[model samples]
Target: MRIQLDDLQGPEIHALLEEHMRGMHALSPPESVHALDLDGLRQPNVRFWTAWDGADLLGCGALKQLDAEHAEIKSMRTAEQHLRKGVARALLAHIVEQAQALGLRRLSLETGPVPGFAAAHRLYQAFGFQECGPFADYKLDPHSVFMTRLL
Candidate 1:
């Protein structure tokens, strides 16, 4: 798989994000949802990436800088066809490497507590992330499970 910086305007990225939103809507409640739309993903504080296998878009992920030393993971989704094929794992490892390269000492993320998100939660924990209370500007929310890893 090829991982690279992506322009949010790219059609592949747009398609993957649309798919992400649809999946979230189907699996989680509206009030608990915090996934970024195109406008939000294009914000100044965030950097997005798309993974491709030649002409096929495999997945996408992003990092949102929270402050000088912290960043939050965002919009990690693997195409349904690519699920269980290591796309999400590759994207996640790439994101963590980028965070460390940026001098971020910690990475945190919020994911749903729904069954659909179980694999993601486990994947993160396997990467050394631990349950944590919301940090930065995030508030406590019942449907959100917060995890963090010290880089």
Candidate 2:
């Protein structure tokens, strides 16, 4: 699979992001949903990416720069058809590598406690992320699980 920066302008990418947001909202209560919408992902500090296998879109992920030494991972979603295919693993590794290249010292993320997020928690743990309290504008929420790793 090939991974590259995405501008969130194409129909395919837009659809994928829309699906991601819908899924997030479905899995969590309104107050606990933190997934960024299309407009939010377009913010100047956020960099988004997509993974593709030739013409097929496999998954997408993003890195948001919180500060010189910190960043947040966002919008990590694998297409339903691509689930369990290692698309997320590859994309996450790419995100971590890009964060390191940017000289960021830490990478953190917030995911839900729902069963749908089990694979994500395992993946993050395998990458050395440990559970942590919320960071960046986030408050303690029973539905949200925050994880972070040092670069």
Candidate 3:
């Protein structure tokens, strides 16, 4: 799959992100849902990308720069039909590589603790991410599981 920077303007991506937001809200309570909307992902500090297999959009992910040496992974979602096909894995690997290239010293992410997030937890763990307390603007929430890794 070809993974590249995305401008977030395509209808396919818009639909995907909308689906992502809906899924997040469905799995977690309103207060626990941290998934960004289209406008939020368009912020200057956030860099977004989409993974594609020729004409098919496989998945998408993003990194939000929190400071000079820190970043947070956000909006990671794989298409429903593409689950278990390494779409999320590829996007994550690409995000990590890009973070290192940006000279970032740490990468952090917040995901849910529900059954729906089991695969995500395993994915982060396999990439060397360890559970951590809340970072950035986040507060302690039982619904959230924060993970981080030093670059």
lDDT of 2 by residue, 96-147 (tens): 9999999999999999999989999999999999999999999999999999
lDDT of 3 by residue, 18-106 (tens): 88989999999999999989999999999999999998998999999999999999999999999999999999999999999999999
Question: lDDT tens digits, residues 35-95, model 1?
Answer: 9999999999999999999999999999999999999999999998899999989999999
If scored against the real structure, what TM-score would every candidate get? Answer: 0.96, 0.98, 0.99
Instruction: Name model 3 segments beyond 4 Å from true.
Output: none
The C-alpha lDDT values of all candidates are 0.92, 0.95, 0.97
How much lDDT does candidate 3 score? 0.97
Using TM-score as the yardstick, the better of models 2 and 3 is 3
User: Which prediction has the highest TM-score against the true structure?
Assistant: 3
Worst 10-residue lDDT window for candidate 1 reads 7-16
Model 3: per-residue Cα lDDT at residue 132: 99
lDDT at position 89, candidate 3: 95
**Model 3: residue 130 alpha-carbon error in angstroms:** 0.5
